[model samples]
Target chain A: MKKQRNLTMAITGFVMLLVLHGTAYGLSDVFKENIYVPEKLAPTDSVLKVAVGEKAPDFTLPSVHHGKISLSQFIGKKNVVISFVPAAWTPVCSDQWPGYNIVKDLFDENDAILLGITADNIPTLFAWTNQMGELWFPVLSDFWPHGGTASKYGVLRSDGTTERAIFVIDKKGYIRYIDVHNINKRPPLESIMSELKKLNQ
Target chain B: MKKYFVVVMGIVLCLVVSGSSLAFDTKPPAVGDVFPEITFSIPGESDYRTYLGLSKGEYFSIQDIKAKVVVVEVLSMYCPHCQREAPRVNQVYDLIEKDPSLRGKIKLIGIAAGNSTYEKKVFRERYGVPFPLFEDADFELHDILGGVRTPYFIGVRIDSGVPRVFYSKLGGFESADEFLRMMIELSGL
Candidate 1:
């Protein structure tokens, strides 16, 4: 009787294994059926970081000179490019902001408004802009609540600093292009130009 | 003695017939359904160790784990999506960990597939994951959980054993909040 009970248990365990195997096979087949898109797909939902093909969330941030420039303020007249940076005095940011300032004319040629955003407070932004020899674009200060705009954009790191991400919003308020590269790497300039060129066409 | 033998034979026959009923239960996980029994191998243990052989305790079975809402993340350490999600998941984990009422009410299991001890250690150190991350060699758990790609999430209800795929890609890490809120509602917690 004991031997018979042991045999039954063994058979039951064996069958459980077989069942698991069969279920796995069917599920794997289903998994393989859904192929990945070759390029960036449209955002399923509106997230903090601007996703491609989604309407950009509107906000009113204090501009350096203007009392406040709302995102909607640019809706009908200009394409908007919000450049999120980690901080003002960092090496890469120094180079990045100056690069934007140097290309300010090109950006205008494409009918885009370039605004640099950082966690630095208004006083600090003012000081940095002066020290950096006057930036053409408003170095918008997201300072009182450091990186508030960055948080809304989903680019704020746990460390309370914004990531270096470029968001391009067309006149209609739809996000046209977004490129968020790793902190160490600068985005390819050609890619940004190409995306802008698409808007022009 | 004869009476005892007769009773034992009846019991043995019943066991045999029940054993034959081992077909797969075709009922899939509904939106809020819980899950079946799940046994995972603990990482950092001996590689030569035998497959884990144990029963689901009264409260810790897969059924129990699913009795509340759960998000099972199956990922590989080498996958970039997994790495990116690691920080965000850690943020979510920290939020839950700090809440006294929410502690232990939700379950987030990270199954690391095809990772060596070094890799798992790096992830564990970097993310400071509070829960056990079972190692799944060659994606055995991935196969069981529907051959999901790395960084995929299987959101399941604890009471119904029902599962729904919330994410199937590398970029869905940003939706951790949404995933957690849905889990809370579905788990009835």
Candidate 2:
């Protein structure tokens, strides 16, 4: 009877260990936070106002980090890649700039600087971009005139937001490549890297 | 009589534990479905040590892993959610390393969706991840895996060179210990 009791105790202890081991590891309490942004009712209409091989129209705009940034300031010094997103706090736009944030070395390797342009005001840009860690490039706002810089590049949508576009300008301020992508889709990084390679060559 | 009681009790405990873990459903290659075989490369010898068991600078395919259980993470360097989940994922890796029974039988790897080699390296360095991270620049792995969201996880059980998906989660797991336990329970390891 004592042997049977010991057996029962040993089995109970082993099962208890298993149960304790399982329960000791609790579920994480840090749930993912959701960011709220309004969705667009209609697809943006693409209208190309500028073409490659032409001189890029220069503009000065207020930056979220700095007081002001001028496109022509880097023309004689380094190549520039102007990234235009539709609006602030939206899903695709939020992910786009952060993706570029990790690739600062890629831009540095090709002797180029990235300028993120959006039609939203400074305060909105500040709140939206702060969610995306630290960004190495300047995020410029074209808010006062309502996408004036985006309009000059022919990427302004009818909804007052800019189309998802990329403009690669050479050191001499000539447009080398222009990609006006669908507002819903992300422009792949490989395409931009290849364009930058062309500029280096 | 005592031996019989011990055997019966152990069997009952096993059934109860495994039954509770099977209640959750996730995206495909659901439990028992064959995990697709994919090929990818990683830089340096250290990253390959715990993953493919290959020497430094050698490319490895899914079939090369000798472990009975494998965990694959589909992530993107530019994804904010993935960036936030990195440290937790690292903790899972550490848990697996520390556990004696799971050390050699289970392995963890990451596939960086839409990230280039340079970008993957930057993420690894920034997050201090010790697992082997591979670049899916063209998103071939992403397309093959049915376009799951960032920080997605897939756990597989290997049976004679054929991998069957045993566990899948869309987002980050709550905790490393819980995740490790789930993987072990689902894989029946």
Candidate 3:
């Protein structure tokens, strides 16, 4: 009778595993609905201090998964795309990073590395990005100095949040394109790709 | 015995949570319901516009599609699951096209939640997607259809000019052939 019971338990376990695999496994690993959304804010809240053709500012920042990454590390090797999102969990920010996740090859084709920056700290960024599935690029935190890098580029808003912006820097550390986009909208991917193509040329 | 019980309980909890996310969270469109009227922008490409049988228009509604059955895929370019499901979906599209009986009778399109035109374009190019895809940059189309998760599939039959849904499910499918069979069977083709 004990042997029969053990067999029954083993069978039950196998069935449960199959059910989980079909319905639940890996599907829940990423974030889903139930995000807390806030009302719309000003279109473009900050002015950019950096301009096209200016030398891009170099900084060292902590990443969610990787250790400290410096802008100078890729200065002479790869073009860099600095994406400054306003906040985590908000409407545009959540979708923007995931969109970039799909086009890693495009960035690589142009010899560019994208660095996603926001004022939210490590834990916040970790929890936020954890739901975005697997991102291909390093997501750095500008939290310690409270939007310090954003301020350096003049993207820090009056309310301490960064502007939804894009800055494309060439291999020689010169700013090639700057789009301090409207805070309420995402900078279209075509514009970014167009700018990256210029760096390739 | 206690350890075994804990493991079982953990698995059960995961199912319960995942179940809610599957469909009930936002009351997604289900079988036997009238699919919402989604006015999609006609793709600028001539091939896509011709595939949908749309002519000279900024937008066209579901009723405008010239097919007996339309397969609508609600996806997000940012969604890893959607990215993984893209190839399988493309296979389904190919199988449907090769089957002469299903050709012109069935069509496939994608509605990308929170994806802009440019983002949607990148997804199409990256996946080599053959079907026409529309952007739902603000989630308007998603909310109208009941805010479901990515990789959601809805099979609608428009035989008599009104779209009546026959299949609606969240998450991904197992096999391309199996999925195509289901769509064909459910639409009564």
Candidate 4:
């Protein structure tokens, strides 16, 4: 009986290992394939319309998750990070927001909220962003006045798309930092973190 | 009965040892160290087979490839830097393929850190990357690779029959030509 019991225990242990291995393998494969959106090259020409120490222009725009979001609401309550991308569905733009998704905790640690703005329409923004998993921040559309917010900030390209830009606004409504990155490249995350550290101080 | 107990204990010990290795927290391989062996299936088998001359349905290991030098790009489908560097990396692959001296002597592969197979496929198709790319859904390879930032490059020299990391960079290279030249120089090929 003792021999039988030992054999049973060994078999049980082996089965458990197999089950765990199978579960992990199955989980990896279960992530259903998503749509493949071809990437577009963004233009390099960018215009910076705003400067540091300026009050960020307040505006309301439609959100992908919420109906409408305004810049002024977070002025006194929270430090705001405004991330402007050139457009939706482009290589840089698509990768930019999803990168932000992983760094949401960094924004939270700095007591900031990120507002992702693009010149694409709501429908376009919805479809494009859905390709990325759930985003922790709001994505706003500057579509209808056709880049009104972008133009106000001087980042609007001649073609009506926004420049790849970032504005760190302090709680008192003053822009603390500004980066008008080349439209073709991504602004390094470390630089943004360094700027946020200054805002925290 | 004692023999059975010993046998059962041995089996249990083996299971625990194997499980622990897969339980995460393996220190990432560092510069000058032999690259750790990892088995992964590349997404889009046909592309890899045709482009890299790999066999169909075969799992790949860093030590198994026949090349004098290997460039391993640790990236993520969601990383903006990786996305921007995609075309540039393709250029590196093109140079490796087109150069008569470098042909069959150099290989390029990408590991999509923390990305699922589905995500890896999307990235591969979107970028039109001709090289083989694998998904590290559990981040096993990423953790083994030191959890470095995405768009990082690790160059391995295999001329000694044992692969050792010779170069590692945190961000994108300035240009494809510059990167290719650096790899060739570092590989001493």
Candidate 5:
């Protein structure tokens, strides 16, 4: 009887261990739905020391497209989508830019211009642009000063890097949408599309 | 026969001893529950067993830090929010490091979901984060804390028996300062 009890107990313990392992294996996907941000509280702010609803701070950053372009140039005509990436070669930004590239026409149809801003130097941006294909959109270099554009948007990290932030500015230069994401999770395209729809409406 | 009984008793005692270690049942620290005994290994230059571990004090039940306030930072190498908040967290670490009373009382710990040593090293070098980060590859402690995303924070108060979790979130971009201030307040010291 004693031996039988011990055997049964050991078997039960083994089963529990297996159960724990099985449950843990599915944890990442179980919590996947909790990964998103609620749409209402986006980081909508103007440049450094500036508030949202105020005119966005404008500057001319070197573009990967050959010539420098002032953000002011896009005013009154094109709704601008400014995507802030931490660095050029990082994995998240790599997927993010390509995703934007695939949807370039969608932005154009919505009367918007998509610009990717990064702290990486112009040379790195140039290499990435060339490798990533002839990017119709401009890859802005905030490199010399390091995150000058990111700082203006209050999305620059203290370590002199840009946070992954997505901002949609209306034709009148009023900030229409903002979505700052955790580095690992991709920015929600559905949310961005919805915000764009609202702006278009 | 006498020797056989002695051997059987010895075997039973060994079973009890081993079973006790395997029978750990730590409850998840909810908002009101205090932080429990945190027991995990930290990695050093040579040995994996001898990294600095948090001092084990009497367990508190109320949501509180053993010292005063505890800032639990849930981090992942792939998390952009964590990366962005890394420099900010380092800034707060500097502040906490400067204050002697708040040193051991209010603490910052980075919990990663089993990141590579190279990645972690880059994170440390790139952000200049001063606090020691804990790796939980097995998701054992991560499961206990119920942390879903990286760059998340769980504030605890250790005034009572168990450390009570006061605030918990998956990311820290919007509430960095507010969270720090709350930790300072919770740390009665």
Candidate 6:
């Protein structure tokens, strides 16, 4: 029931935000205090599945920022950082990805790329992320199969949501770092950047 | 269409309720209210540290600074509002420096709520923000400031040991000179 309601809200919210796009408020600032974040849930709900040094499971997902993105596409060219956020509109999730916008240089400097993944549908993710501001990296959805990618990563929570996690895959496709963070708190991007730096070193 | 409309109304209803609840709960420092004592990490940069009059220290509070009036811009690098207001903020800093009376008397600093150190640096580099911006990485300061929206500004008067709030508002200021004028008048400096 709650899931149905959220989908409903997500669609409407997207339309509403599109309507708000042309208003006087700066496009970037429109997201402040507007999202409906639910009360805190289990901090770390899922059991660990993937770990450091393992081959990261590759998957393809649709992206609004880009047409489609796959983990395997950057195997030899660029080190990849796959960020699996639990959901959109939640407090930490909203802050975390938008926070990545400023660190595009850090990612580029380290010759690394970032992919934001979620269990929500494309329209839902679009509605939620659009208000947060421009995201330089591609944001993909694992919705049709519904948490298929997150399940493979073992960060999918029991409640059908994914965990707040980050997986850093080296250019050679080996996982260098995995931080399946506490759901209630934000995982600092610097830690991920540090991992990127280490991979380059 | 009816179902979709109902859902939209429900979302709108929740937004209104949420805004109202936040308004009721957030009691940030008002005019004449005593500003809380919060320590900021001493800027690693030498000039900024000297500007704040901190010779050597890991942390310093607003009261520790030598200025009589302090303008605190509570912002986030990720906030487009703050990004847009960055140049105007820099202009205000320049004005303060050029104005002999305001110079050395009034100080401006930014508190980037929920931003990491690197994120703050990125914001500074991207926007050319001249003033020292302290990081509230854990959002401890943000929660203390009532979790107010970004681009919030507060003018503090530290005539005595404790800082007193003089001007507080949320969102971007239209004019830098007028904002500085208001800050000067309100701070009575």
DockQ score of the complex predicted as candidate 2: 0.08
**What TM-score does each of the candidates earn?**
0.39, 0.66, 0.75, 0.48, 0.41, 0.80
Per-residue CA lDDT of candidate 1, range A23-124, in tens?
221111112223222222122222355578999887778877767767888988999888887666543344355435445666877898887888877876
Candidate 1: C-alpha lDDT:
0.58
Docking level for model 6: incorrect
The collision pairs in model 2 are: none
Candidate 2: Cα lDDT at B7: 89
- Judging by lDDT against the true structure, name the best candidate: 3
Chain A TM per candidate, in order of listing: 0.72, 0.80, 0.83, 0.78, 0.73, 0.82
Candidates sorted by DockQ, descending order?
6, 3, 2, 4, 1, 5
> Poorest 10 consecutive residues of model 2 chain B by lDDT?
B19-28
Output the lDDT of residue A79, model 3.
95
Most DockQ-accurate candidate: 6
lDDT of 6 by residue, B1-189 (tens): 668667677777676554443334355678998887677888889999878878777888888888999999988876767877889999999999998878888999998887788878888988898889988877667756766678889999997778999988888889999999999898988
Model 5 lDDT per residue over B89-110, tens place = 8777777667776565676667
Clashes of each: 13, 0, 1, 4, 27, 0
TM-score of chain B of 5: 0.65
For residues B53-152, what per-residue lDDT tens digits would candidate 2 score against the true structure?
7666556667578688889998877787788889999999898888887787888889887677767777888889888888877666765665556777
Question: What is candidate 2's local distance difference test score?
Answer: 0.77
Q: List the residue pairs that clash in candidate 6.
A: none
Ranking the candidates on lDDT from highest down gives 3, 6, 2, 4, 5, 1
**What are the per-model DockQ values?**
0.03, 0.08, 0.10, 0.05, 0.02, 0.16
lDDT of 4: 0.75
Off by over 4 Å in 4: A1-46, B1-73, B77-189
Candidate lDDT (C-alpha), each: 0.58, 0.77, 0.82, 0.75, 0.61, 0.80
Q: How big is the positional error of residue A6 in model 5, measured in Å on the Cα after superposition?
A: 33
Q: For candidate 6, what TM-score does chain B get against the true chain B?
A: 0.85
Model 6: per-residue Cα lDDT over A1-201, one tens digit each: 677668777766654453333111111345766665554577788887788989998899999779888889998999999888888766567667766876788899999898999899999999988876678999999887989999988999998889999899999999999998888767766788788889978
Tell me which of candidates 3 and 5 scores higher on lDDT.
3
Instruction: Residues A1-201, candidate 4: write the lDDT tens digits.
Output: 766786768766665654353211111111123322232334445567678998888899999998899989997788999999987765456656776776777788898999999999999989877766687899999998999998888888877778899999999889999988866556766677778889977
